[model samples]
Target chain A: MTCQELLDLLHDYVGNELVIESRTTVEVHISGCLQCGTLVHAYTHTVRVARALPKCNPLPAAFEARLRAMIEPELKDKPAE
Target chain B: MFDPPPEKLTPEIVFREYAPRIYNIARRMLGNDADAEDVTQDVLLQVVRKLDTFRGDSQIATWLHRVTVNAALAHRQKRANRQKHESAEADDDVLGSGGPVTPGKRWEVGPEESVLAAEQAAIIEKAIEQLPEPFRDVYVLADVEGLPNNEIGEMLGLSLAAVKSRLHRARLRMRDLLAPHFEGKVTS
Candidate 1:
């Protein structure tokens, strides 16, 4: 792959989201091109950092109870079969 | 056997299944805890109110995200309108404390990492946040949420080419923004 083409594919490449042939070409380019290689490293590091944000509990246990109560008004008077 | 209509739209089911992903997207889009929680709640409430309309043609997550983006956009609009009317009000009152709430600087790093990694991450988040909505939406969905381009296209109702273009531009812009911190990691 040319430098520009490889650079364009670098995002997907580092995400490991690229197709096999494209990945091979990216690897080939990275093997010989120091500049493209650094770009790939930066992209990979960025993806790692983005993914590493702490996954917190999105809501408390009581939230479900609260949400159920809030939504129940819409369900009132439905035939209780 | 004929079936009776459903008794209720269960927030429990939706919350259990979808809340984490919804919160993740909200955090990325809205960039704060309170707003993300509010957006998450609003999206779930909308789901409950509109469950019957969910014809199930697409994945539930995509439909939920459409509700999310809509709700967030509405909230932003409302906030903007209020700000316009209160242009003379104390900026602190509008901002809810002081000069832009500082984002947490620390990463949940493994015990062995160096300071360089943390600095890189901070730079990257700043860069991601600076991207315009269309590009940021596709970038977060694809890169952060790990969705495929096809699914991202479906979620945003864009063509694959359009998604690719936005994603590429988002990355390029981010690379430029991050160049200072990532100096050794990219060539000019």
Candidate 2:
């Protein structure tokens, strides 16, 4: 695979979404080309950092209380038999 | 994972268990706290009213995921339309330009910079907010929320190949957005 090809496929490659044959070709290319290898490393690092982002903040207590109040009547309705 | 029968799910239980997760997804998807809360309430209320329709065909979590995604997307669309009507100014620039990506010089994160995880996370979140809607949804589902591509396709009504393509483009854009920060060229 050329560097450009490797760059294009880097996302799937890092995510392990590429088919085995295509993955092997990109792997071989990265092992041989320093520039492509660095680029792949950078891409991998980017995904890792993005995935490691903080979990979403918890729902606010006030909002939760309001949501509960809004839905309480519906919750109390009898279900269809 | 097995879900309890639909009849067994109480609103209180659902709220206690799933509200935080749904809020998180909406918050990330919409990039605003108020909108996220609105989505959380909308999805939870819909779940309450429609609980009887949920057969045991899928896990409750999966069903909730679908509901949350749909509600968040609808909210985003309404907000966009409202913004358009409220201002005569064409806000085309608010959507990203997908500009040319130049790989920055300092591509690799060195050991000295390891402490910047929180800062990097903030930058990454901002970058994600700037991604176009199609790419943003796939990226957030696959990368941020760790949902599989097939599930994301189902959630977004996209084909598997389309999901992969959008995800690839999103990741590339994320890398480009982050390069300048890592290179110390852009300081927040």
* Best model per TM-score: 2
Candidate 2, residue B37: Cα displacement in angstroms equals 1.7
Off by over 4 Å in 1: A11-23, A54-81, B1-10, B13-17, B32-38, B50-59, B73-125, B176-188
With a 3 Å backbone cut-off (N, CA, C), the pairs that clash in candidate 1 are none
Candidate 2, residues B1-188, lDDT tens digits: the string is 11344446666667776778888888878888899999998888887777766534457777778888999988988887888743322232433432334544535465334244667778888898887677877888888877899999998888897777777777777777877777543222
| Candidate 1 lDDT tens digits, B1-188 | 00122344344455555666666677676666667777877887676666656434344655666677667656656665777852222121221211111211222323234243555556666777786666777777776666678877876667887777677666655555655654542223
TM-score attained by model 1: 0.61
Give TM-scores of the second chain, every candidate. 0.58, 0.72
lDDT of all predictions? 0.59, 0.72
Which of the numbered candidates is closest to the native, going by highest lDDT?
2
CAPRI tier for the interface of model 2: acceptable
Q: How do the residues A4-76 of candidate 1 rate in per-residue lDDT, one tens digit apiece?
A: 7776666567667888999998898888976666656555555555555433335655655675576566555
Model 2 chain B worst lDDT window (10 residues): B86-95
Which segments of candidate 2 are over 4 A away from where they belong? Answer: A54-56, A78-81, B1-8, B52-58, B85-101, B105-117, B183-188
